[model samples]
Target: MINKLSIVKLNPIIIREDRKNYIVEDRKNGEFYEMPNPAVDAINLINKGKPLGDIEQILKVKYPNEDIDIIDFANQLLDLELISEVNGELILKEVDQFGPTGFLWIPESVSRFFFNKYSYIFYISLLLFNIYILLTNHHLLPNYKDYFIFSWMSLNILLWLGIGGALLILHEFGHIIAMRANGLPTRLSIGHRLFFIALETDMAAAWKLPSGKRNVLYLGGLCFDMVAFACALSIQYFYPTGPALLLAIMKILVIDIFIRFIFQCGVYMKTDLYFVIENISGSYNLMENAHHYIKSKFKKEARKAGEAVYEEEKRTIKSYSVIYFIGVLLTILVFVFYSIPQIITTMSHSIDRLSSPLFSKPFFDGAIVLVQTLTGLSLLLYSWYKKYRLKKE
Candidate 1:
């Protein structure tokens, strides 16, 4: 038990809010802890160096009948790193954000003016216009030939890099704008998510927001991507004689962005939809619990088990588990029926390029091809391995 007579204190915790909840952010550790209103009141009092006994007495007098265990409450905060002792000791554990490298933090006041509700209205209008254009001019959509008709080198790669880079920036900006609209100061960072490098946002502030607004933060990126594709398609339609490279670029954007949008539905991938489902169900550990349900039902690891799966999240997780299973099955089918063939075709093409003696700059081209082949194979192996591991579990 914490000493009732001893001093308790709040760390450098920043209290913030959104539509649904209050979150106490311990910035020193990049962590946020959700708190009830009473807990928030107690913490703020503790921040001023209130003693444990005095804080409990104050809460008892204020609420009269509520059972307020200030010691246990403070202990929980201590566990979450939301509060610390004032004895001048240093923290020892390692807690890192996804990517803290060369982080770019735009002050909210600087960008808040640009991200009001009107901005979303403009995005929606542009989206509607794009839809109209697509209906009236279906001929403008890109074809497979558009991708390969170019030199696919030098300027081609440069333009693709530039455009794709800009799109990704806009994508991250969408998240930043969403946070700003919700009155949160957001820091955008570049990070490595597993094997792939990505630009990510610090939406820890998002924990305080309502699920509706939380989803806005998630959907914001795809909005930018779609708007970009719509613009690219419009440009391609107006200039049939426009650089074939633009067509190639349009094709690339369409394929990449659409595939990415679809990929987000992979609850197993911990995509945006995964969080959306979690928020909708009010279960933060939905996927983890879903797997637990799977284990119990399938008797995979439960053969040695006797305890029941906790029901706190069972109803929500069971429904989610079914969807999760469907997503996994679809992903497996996609890999087996589609991805393997594409990988083989690309590998064959690369092999032929490497063997073609008359090809200029064969070494440089072969290196790129080898990297592509290796990446594809690595992804295939990882996917199967992950599936195998889950089955074993």
Candidate 2:
């Protein structure tokens, strides 16, 4: 129970997330806890040496009978480790202010070239030309599976993985560059979203930027991906298949990158497009509200949650709930009917290749098979872990 006399201060580690919300980062455990806007404002006042009574009085004047309990809010912040008590008073911890900007830091100097608006226009124009050439030359286009030249061998898969990994790095750079273009500093790190390992750009700071710019920043990754796919397509138009292996590589790059591009449309998966819609609609809590609204249709327990949502947000959430439901249903159908079966088949085929008599004789080839098998297995396990065990960290 934080009382009026108890002096409290905001933990410096608790970052102001977006334009309207806050999130506390646990440096020790790599966790993020989102905070409500009101409590965050009170913490800001508290950090300025205001007593709890003063904070309560100020909030009372500001909100005017919103029934805000500063004491309870401050207690919650304490429980969340967003503020710490030191000798009857909360104190802020001093840490390196600009240290550890996520797993991969993008310094301004190297990334400056990417932030240029003129360069974006050039890149887009080139991509459009590439796409035009690709669409018209349908006869030269290879089948998607034609890229699997060695029947899922380790070396071939590794080549594809290397290309995909490089593209992912550029994809993240696109986000950083876009943020920098808007005169915003960005931090990025490697993190997980369910079963997927993802690059997290700390766009929480972008909340202060115009919503239009923020939306473009959210799309930066896709922008890079499109450029990559275009480059691969361009190569296809020039080489056409004279080099044999070049065609396979280009086809692989084109196909894989395009698939990843489509992955952005996965609203149920909270992909980039989801954030775009959320930001564009000004519904910061769209996902949470949408989940409740969708659930309330059939689940009695969710009715209160649906009711608790703000009226303005409810319209956006309700509309989004329908889209969310459709997206989820389609994902389930695709995974259950095609994706799971294809994976199982690939694993079986890989096992057969590894168990062959020739595999035992040539150590290198066998090693490749082993790597491919382990990679597949690791992804499966990661997916399960993400769905069942992973949370916020």
Candidate 3:
């Protein structure tokens, strides 16, 4: 177990330097560790094929006043499974690769077309066109009634789920494709953001990219959402009296896109917009820091909390606290004004339909509603458990 002569072989590591610390990333698993100068120097020596003894001597000579522990640092790396081998023996651990699983067939050149400077211009143009259409054709703006396209509640729910699910996939695909274009790995997963279930792209590896490049990746999903909304609006604008079924579906798409946009605006939850803001501001752990800052205000620990964050990030986090509260207020407003009313109306209608004759259409619709409600509650509870209790245990 002694390590004076131990030669450590490391797995692929990518180091990114921010204002405060060196973010040492285990590329194989997308794990990151914040390390100080000494630790980073030790890592550099290890990469240069220097034995542990040499590393210790080098670090000790370099930082004469500081107490440096190369062996302990190597052990920490070992625990993280970043060590690939020791003196010719394999030490790397088996773990799931969190890289791109789909769309590998698409070349980087092709995917890059979507995020190039010109594409952003197109995205903005389309967004403006959609706004113009909405302003000119006020009737096309989504109303709450647009959500109830079908007479049967269950049918409407099924239709929306089908279309919304597709849109969600496209939204996530935008992120995935953009990531691949940047020669990075990411995958889509489901997670809860407060009361909502969202499809998210795991872009932990994105830290390797420059902050400017990462903004494109972060905004990828929203860009696709805007494109979809614009396309649907354009079609409806040109053919106002199109086939009834097609027009009805377009109306549902508009409502789905509109709600999703509003949902992303509530950045208190980890939305795509939140990542963009965090990336552009160069603020690490903005969400957690902003949260701490807000709590500290009431407890009079604002100074302490402020000190805990990086010096460069202090001002940004303080400002972000304001945005965080605004986002929370937006969520509260949506919950009170839209969600509560929708829930009450749906439940009341379902209960009334449940009283209808057995095996009738109304009774079936009511049964479907009950099942849907129970399923949604189950998913929400499961998400909460997975996020909190399961992780601790």
Which candidate gets the maximum lDDT versus the true structure?
3
Q: Tell me the tens digit of each residue's lDDT in model 1 across 1-393.
A: 466776755556678653334666676775666665778788878877778889899999888867799878877766776555633444354555532322235555655554556767777777787677767876654333333433423333345456656777888887776676666656765543233345667776676565566877776776677678776776777777877666667767764554455456668777767877877766766777777777787685662341455555667777888888787776666456544554565455556667756546654565576775466457656656665776896
Per-residue lDDT of candidate 3, residues 153-214 (tens digit): 88877887789889989999899888888887666667787776667788877777766688
True-structure lDDT of candidate 2 = 0.67
Residue 264 shift from truth in candidate 2, angstroms: 1.3
Clashes of 1: 1
Model 1 error, position 80 (Å): 3.1
Cα-based TM-score, every candidate? 0.68, 0.75, 0.85
Residue 140 miss distance in model 1 (angstroms) = 6.7
lDDT per residue for candidate 2 within 150-233, as digits (tens), equals 754566657766776787788887887777666666686655544445666877656545556677788787777777777778
Poorly placed runs, candidate 1 (over 4 Å):
12-22, 27-30, 36-75, 86-114, 125-147, 150-166, 180-197, 208-212, 236-241, 300-315, 329-342, 358-364, 371-393
- Which one is best on TM-score? 3
- Checking candidate 3 for backbone clashes, the offending pairs are none
Please list the residue runs of candidate 2 whose C-alpha ends up more than 4 Å from where it truly belongs after superposition: 11-50, 80-110, 123-143, 176-212, 329-367, 379-393
TM-score of model 2 (CA atoms): 0.75
